[model samples]
Target: MSLVGSNPTLSATVRWLRVHWGTGSQVKNRTIKWLLGLAWVTAGLYFADKGATYYRQGRTLPPSVINTIPEMPPHRAGDRVLVFAPHPDDEALGCAGVIQQAVQAGAQVWVVYMTSGDGFRLAVERQFRQSHPSPELHIQFGKMRQQEARRAMRLLGLADWRILFLGYPDRGLYPLWSSNWTPSNALRSYYTDTDTNPYRDTLHPGVTYCGQNVLRDVEQVLRRTVPTHVYVTHPADDHPDHAATALFVMSALARLRMQGIGFAQRVVLRHYMVHCGDWPQPQGLHEDEPLTPPPAFFNIGLHWVKLNLTPPQQVRKMNAIKAHTSQMLMMSRFLQSFVRQNELFIEQPVVLPIEASLGVVWEEPDEEDILRNLQAPGDFSAAELRMENGQAVFHINTRSKPRPGFSYSCTVHALLPNGDVTTTLLRTKPGRQSADARVDEDGVTFRLPALPSGSVLVLQAQSRFAGLAVDKTIGHVVRLP
Candidate 1:
């Protein structure tokens, strides 16, 4: 009472509590209980409202976002569309909408899988219930995935004959692209334990698991289909197999172009990204949401296009994705994330030849933060190629200065008119000098044998630290002067 006399507001509060709860130890306990109850109810309502708002926002797509991307060109009756997938389920995840639309438009569509997705150990363990699956078991897993692919394609309105599997190693495409290009150095898959295509129905039965064979098979498919539009994975995809598929496809198209194949000239090339860092946000089935590119790709010089789907088309896509029972057992939510109101693709520009005299420059966006803590030095800032003093010269610039424990390399592919590809590799590491390569403060340069005129040259520059590739440039195709 004496304290309350000094503060009128405290006195009024005390009076109110005493009148309502009765003045005693029981009154204090009652007041505390009531306030605690009120807090619990208020917090429950607040969180419930927040959860509802988040759910709504996650499932809904704004018109502004949809309008920002250009619509994909429609497939017509005469169009021949070819889609290349790195794994079994990727076709359904990335291009089921396109396949359905093409079928509805009477366009001929073909789906080619680079691998049967045999290397996923978790899928193998779940499918066959084996912790240490043998090579034969992996082959069986592959065959099962092949059937799943066929069923999924059937759901997308593709006939069995229209689908082809290359049956290359599932996790070995990058090694083929990087180090194993000849039959002598063919890669052996750790999962399948085979250095050759084991599937009987592959495009080329018993082809060696080498880069040249991959290129040859892709070229064969391109020649046979002569597609007007080609869809493959993006070069910047986080998955090594996905990126290698794009490289093989492009190299084949370039070789075909050099051989006077006109399809390479007019074929429209689009890149679909399946694996990026934490992409396709709100990760489960959200049929009403629009699929968009990852934020890291926003300024990467890519022209993005989207294909809107009907409600029926979305349902069909969901069904196609579900056909991959093995994948569903492992990551159903990740697979279902692609079943949205639309699909996304990077509309690649027509491949153009760079004048050797003027040189060519390739610039890659800085994306070191995308994969945390795996910072390998030498993110490619710019790469230039030109002819100087009877030698082909390569000048590569990196984002940061040359550091210890890092190495830079340039691989040049001379696409001869006679259909032979001669590759030259030049590399330089910290405190090491090579005959053809020179490392500077912020870049590296290489001098190589001059390539003949009328031949095409493709250049790729890479940076490695601790034997791990941290960054690389896209294949830069150039013409000799």
Candidate 2:
């Protein structure tokens, strides 16, 4: 009767075994399994918690990172346009909805795939060492990715004629984009062969995707496509490849426009971002948002565009996104859920219809002094002195020389088209130009007072030369707006 009362239930026996023999490999394995399962569930729950928090905070439908709303079909209708896909997934990741909307709205949309995007799978090739270590796997995998991209586009309702693959292998894009082949520790490398690794096929003998060649090739595309409106990658994105592709597109557009192609009648350029973590958090910025625009931003919206994305069009876009199987497997589904909501753009309030103005343009050569809009007096030709909008950016090119026994006042003037100049925006002459503004080979740039909206404002440069002209080059004027 006593033995019958001690019948071992699974839970009771387990508890008894744990209490009696608490530590062993068998027991340890069970404990570890429980802990690991718990850890995984907790991690998943954390993401969900984050999503819930965002939703409650009213930023749920917003971009989890920098991205664009899907382009609607040709609701308003326009001429043919070409969409630039930096990699296999960029087209879907950035603007699948937009492409569907554009197509349905009656625009002839052409898709251009810039690279095969086979380099991202760094994990798969490592398996070769443990299994069959063949260098040929790299090319084989790359080819597979290209096929995946083609299949994805077809799912998005794109025909074969609408696609163009540059096939320019995409692994070392960052190095190529940042270098002019001047040969430095960073840019100089000897690639004899890739026979030892899985990425061997993807490696080339020369720099096929160098920035200059990229710019030239993309420019040719622009002329041939003749797209009235252009879409490219966001310059501020975290990915080097995406940013390089965007830079190429921007350079091409600017060159064409400078050559008299015009930014409006011929084309309009907009950017889209795919990298999630590094996306700008604009909400944290109350006013005068910090710009992530790398190198510089190109604006094309001095005009008007109005198109509404219908529900069906939005569904088509969502479906197109689902077609990217490999990518869909990798990215978060929550991000995909927000694809149809809103297509945001810079109002391009900077570039307006009445851009011509009687504004002052000033330029200075050295870094010692800052200037106002009036071209007070300086060296350099008006043509040689470059200006963007109405401001001149100063490049402290020479090794900066120190000036002693002189009191220099740093001032920033807000040039209003109404000719009202306000010097109140100057924070501190703290004599720390290095800490205050960002300067490089491109030029020095710092925030200026907002030029009152709808007016041509000018940025000026001036410096007080304290009784010496040889130690420092004096009397310089450079205007950048």
Best by lDDT: 1
Model 2: runs farther than 4 Å from truth? 1-78, 122-135, 169-171, 180-207, 262-265, 276-308, 332-338, 345-481
| Candidate 1, 319-388: lDDT as tens digits | 9999999888788888888998899998865455657457666567555342323353477767777777
- Tens digits of per-residue lDDT, candidate 2, 1-481, equal 0001111254475586578566677877877787689789889868865664454334222333223222333434766667887777677756676677666667777777666554444322342342332334544645666666667677667786677766444544445554431223223211111312223222232334444455556777777778876776654454656655765565455445435565433466556656533233332211122222111122221121223345564565556656655455554353363354344332121121222343322222221212211212222222112234644323332223323322122233233444333332221112446433443322233444345553222222223334212221211111223
Candidate 2 residue-wise lDDT at 260: 56
How does each model score on TM-score? 0.82, 0.51
Instruction: Report residue 244 deviation for candidate 1 (angstroms).
Output: 1.3
lDDT of each: 0.81, 0.44
Model 2 is weakest, by summed lDDT over 10 consecutive residues, at 293-302
